[model samples]
Structure formats: C-alpha cells, structure tokens
Target: MARPIWTGVLSFGLVSIPVGLYTATSAHTLRFHQLQRGTSDRIRNRRVNERTGEEVELDDIVKGFDAGDAYVLVEPDELDEIAPGRSKALEINGFVDLDAIDPIFFDRTYYLGPKSKDYAKVYALLERALAKSNRAGVATFVMRGREYLVALKSEEGILTLHTLHWADEIRDPREEVPDLPGSRVSAGAKEMRMAEQLIDTLAMDWDPEEFHDTYRDKVADLIKAKQAGETVEKAEPAAEATNVIDLTEALRASVERARAKGKQSKGKQSKGEQSKGEERKQRTGEQSRQGKGGKQGRTGRRQGRKESGLSELTKAELYERASAAGIPGRSGMKRDELIKALEQAGRQAA
Candidate 1:
C-alpha cells in the first residue's frame, strides 16, 4: 500500500479534521537515461563554480536570494530556524463556488483522506456538506518550505485537494492576441437550421472512455517494434487542410454525413447485440443459422471484403475525387496525401 506523502489537520472555522495528503496522479511514459555514445558509461551532471572552475560538493550548497546586484547567501541553520514546522495542515479560509475558479488555475490534485479514527465523522461531514453546497474550500498549506493555495472539493463522497496557480501566473490574453473586430460572423436562418439538425443527430452522452490517445499508442507500438528488432515502415505525410469556398454546400454536406454516421453506429450496435444473442442460443445445442459457426463464417467473408468507400481507393484516386468535389490544394497532392484529404472530406460529409 502506498503511504500518504504528508499528514496534517484540516481546519475551517471551529472545525478541525486530521487528514492525509496522497498524490492523485502519476506519469506513465517510459523514461530513458543519458549515456556516453561510444562507452557503456552513464552520463551525470555536476555543479561547478564558474570563477574557480571547480566542482562543488552537495553539502556546501546554500540557498541564495539575488537582491539588486548582490547575492545574499542564506545559511542552512538560519532557514531551518524560520521554517514553518513540517505541518501538513490545510487551513481553509473560505468556501467558493466551483464555477468561480477557472480550469486553468488548477495545477495538481491529491486525495485528502481522514488521518485518524476520531476525524472520520468530521471528514465525512465536511465532504457531504461541500457536495450539498456545491462549493470548494479555498485553503492554504505550506509544503517543502513553500506555501501553496489549494481548493478542497468533494469527489464521489471523498475529499480531494487541488493546487491552484496564483492570479499573476495566468497571463492576460489581450496582451498577446490581436483584436479582430470584423471576424465576427452571423449565421443565416437556413444555415442555423441545418447546423442545429446536425448537432441533434450527433448528440450523445459524454463518455471520456470513448476517446483514446492514438498518437501515444502509435509511439508505444513503434518503440515495441524497434525493441523486437522489427523493421518499422515510414509513416506517410499528413494531407493539408482542404479549403471550402462554398459555406452553404459544405454545411449541408456535413449535416448529411453526421446523419449517415448516426445510422451506421446504430446498425453496428444492433448487429453486435444480435450476434451475442445467437452465441447464447448456440450454447443450448440449437442448430440455428445464427450459431457461432455461422457468425464466424460471415466474419471470415467480411474480413476478405474490401472497403468500398475510402479504403478501396488509392491515394491518387482519393485526391482526384476530392479535387472533383471542389476541394482546394488538390493540385499538389500525392497518392498518400490524397487519401488523407479524401478521408477528411468524407468525415466532414458524414
């Protein structure tokens, strides 16, 4: 079992609840070490004094504050004397509406669990109260000699602590972005109706699991192949974005494509359900046409069948189709390039 990184009492008003801070996130990407190219020696970094050109020992290192043109070296003992006691306490100042805090302000999250047996009731009470009120507690805590602003919120009956960025840390967008007064667009009545219909056809409940990190997965697969000493094929270059000159035509095509996709998804789901039912029926020794053997036979034929729409067409063929459909940048497309453009166009249409 993993242990809590910090332990402290969570205080708000007259209420005090002992809590433990546990990390809520971790990095999964594989890490590599630096080494000498020719030799099998591992490379390491060193802290060297610029003036003396000598290496400095870790014990001799001291924290320094640059004030104007001079560096004021702070002694280790002096820092320890003024340091806040290693208290893991989260002292909540006040409660704030969840929407009041911008998503950008959130840095890292941690699970705040009850530290002691006596604190369980109070911790549960606080968690339930925050859930009921839909408010997050703004708290301050000192960790590793640095003070941090934290937002304490309830998640699935458990309390969660999220570190927040300071106000000054968020840059002003106006300073970096240019103003474009004429870029604002007003949708036409017909366009608005078609757009709404498309949205309604594609609307579904939010499921985060439906999406995967395709790029990361592909990278991992490449690494695995390389490790196994397999020759990796070079990936084709991506197709450039198509320029659609006719907005009305593009919008109409997009709506039609979305409706088609919705129908296709429904059909696939129904077929899958039917297949499952058939599998269950075959278990009872019923010699039905919808048996496992029949399903496997159909799957075998489907596997051999070529894709009629985009899959069957070569890159050059796709490019020509896209060009004929009035897509821009079709003149400079190679076979691979055309395939991507056509796929994108088809997606936009569906």
Candidate 2:
C-alpha cells in the first residue's frame, strides 16, 4: 500500500482541510552497485569523524555552519521547533494567476488528497474553485526540517502542490552564461520564415506515451549481450553544428524533411484505420465459422507481414531492423542504406 509523505491541514482564510501529500512522480532508472576492480568485494561508504579519523554513528552528527572564526552547531530538534506552523499546517498566503509564475521556479510535484472521506467535499470545493478561478495558491511549509515555497493548483479534478525555488536561488543567466545570443543578434526574415515552416510541419500534440528512455533500454541490452557473449548495436552519431553561412539553406532543407515525415505518418495512420475497418467486417461475417475464421486470420496476418515494404517504414524502424539483422556499420547507415542492408539480409535468409 502507498503512504503519504506528510499529513497536514491546508489552511486559507478560516477554512482548514486535513490533507495528505503523496509523491506524484517516480524515476525508473537502473541502479548499479560499486565494486572493487580486482575483487568481488562491494564498495560501501561510511561516516567517519574528520578530527578523530574513526567511524561515527549518524545519531552523533549535528548540522554545523562554518563562521569566520568558529563553527555554530545545531540539533534536529531545534529545526523542528523553529519550523513554521509547527510543521503541521500549510498556510496559503494569497492566490495568483497560474501563468504569472515562471516555469523555472517550479520544482517537485505532490498530489494533495483528503486525509479522510469526511474532508472530501471541502477538498473538491477547493479544487473546483481554483480550476474556475485559473489561479494557484502560493504558500510555504516546512518539510524534512527545511522550508519549501509551494504553489497549490487544481489538476484533473484534484489538488496538486508544486514546490518552488526561492527567489534568490535562481541564478542570473546573463551573468553566468558566456557568448549568449541576446536581442542584438537577429536572423534574416527568409531564414525565420523557413524555420517557422519547419516547426509547423513537425508540430505534434504532446503524448508522453509515444516517447521512452531508449538509452536505458540500450544499457539493459548491453548487460544481456555481455552475459551471452554477444555484441550490442550502437546508435548513430549526432549531427554536426549548422554553419551560420548556410542557415537559410539548412532551414529550407529541414522544412522539406519535416513535411515528408508528416506525410509518411499520415499515410501510415490512414492505412491502420483501413486495416481496422477490414478486421471488423471480417469478424462480422465469420461469426458462424469461428474455427475456420481463426485459421484464416493467422494466415492473413502472416501474408500482411510478408507484403509490408521497407519504404513504408520510418528511418527509426529501419534502423531497428538493421540492428536485429546484425548488419555491419548499421549505426552509421543513412535511411536508404538501412533499407538496402535489411532487404539484402532478408533475401539471404530466404
């Protein structure tokens, strides 16, 4: 069962609602243990007293700030005692338009749910009211002995809290960044138009499900290949930096490429829809002959796979096939090269 990281009362004006803060996101990163190079021993870290050069227990440690001439030490109990609202109340100071806050200020996210069924109505009221007002409640509360500036907003019929970076925590980019292309730098109107056209051609609705951590998958593949005494396929090298002198030409070519990709995607989508319609018709007619229909369906799927051409597939799909076929230098192959290599491999297998 999942548990709330913190249980507290959300306060605004005179109304207070008991809420629990649950983590909204999790990472699926692969972890590895550190080990000695020549032995099977695992490498582990330990806390040690700097002055005594001896191992120390966590309970004996205290937070210290280095002053000009001395160290000021503090205990965990002192932090909790000084925490705002006794670290049990989330007091919202005021509400502001959601767009008013810059995205850079946002940090971690947490779902705020009613602690009990009795407070559900009040929680729903706050969520709906915030959604209608299109505003976020700005607030601050202490967690893990540190105070956090947060924004409370309604998302998908529920309240979500986002911890924010304090004002002074944001670095000044102008001072830190070197050779920045500021407002003084400008692109030609023709180049700008081509760039905009490229963006329009490649524009897509945000669907996170369509994307994944390919690098992590490759890492897992690498480990499995090592276990089997085989090699893993590598990806292509990144493109070189665009030349400033050929900016217009680059933009024009990019627009053309994006348009071609968009056309290919639309064509595939249309074909998929047509296939689904045909399947529905077949199922409707084969209702009386289920056994015969099952055999025909399997044969039809095999024939469909055999009939599909390399040209209909995307570059990424072609690359995957080349990788599986173990084609030499597959990583560096262009789209046309990948298709040719895969076709030859298929002919050889046949």
Residue 197, candidate 2: C-alpha displacement in angstroms: 1.0
Off by over 4 Å in 1: 35-42, 51-55, 75-87, 179-198, 233-239, 242-244, 279-350
**Highest-lDDT candidate:** 2
Evaluate model 2: give its TM-score. Answer: 0.80
- Over 239-307, each residue of candidate 2 has an lDDT whose tens digit, in order, gives 999999988888888888888887886776566446544544443344333334477766653443344
TM-scores of all models?
Answer: 0.71, 0.80
The C-alpha local distance difference test score for the whole of candidate 1 amounts to 0.72
Maximum-TM-score candidate: 2
Clashing pairs in 1: 257-349, 257-350, 258-350, 315-335
| lDDT accuracy of residue 230 in candidate 1 | 86
**What is the Cα-based lDDT of residue 138 in candidate 2?**
95
Off by over 4 Å in 2: 84-86, 276-350
**Tens-digit lDDT string for candidate 1 (1-350):** 66998888899999988778899988755566799999889988899998998999989999999998999998867754674553456788999999999999999999999877877899999999999999999988777667789899999989999999998889887786677334475667987898788788778877443333545545666788998998666778996554645667877888889988778766755654454334333323332232455676555323322222445765444553564445676654545566566545544543
lDDT of each: 0.72, 0.80
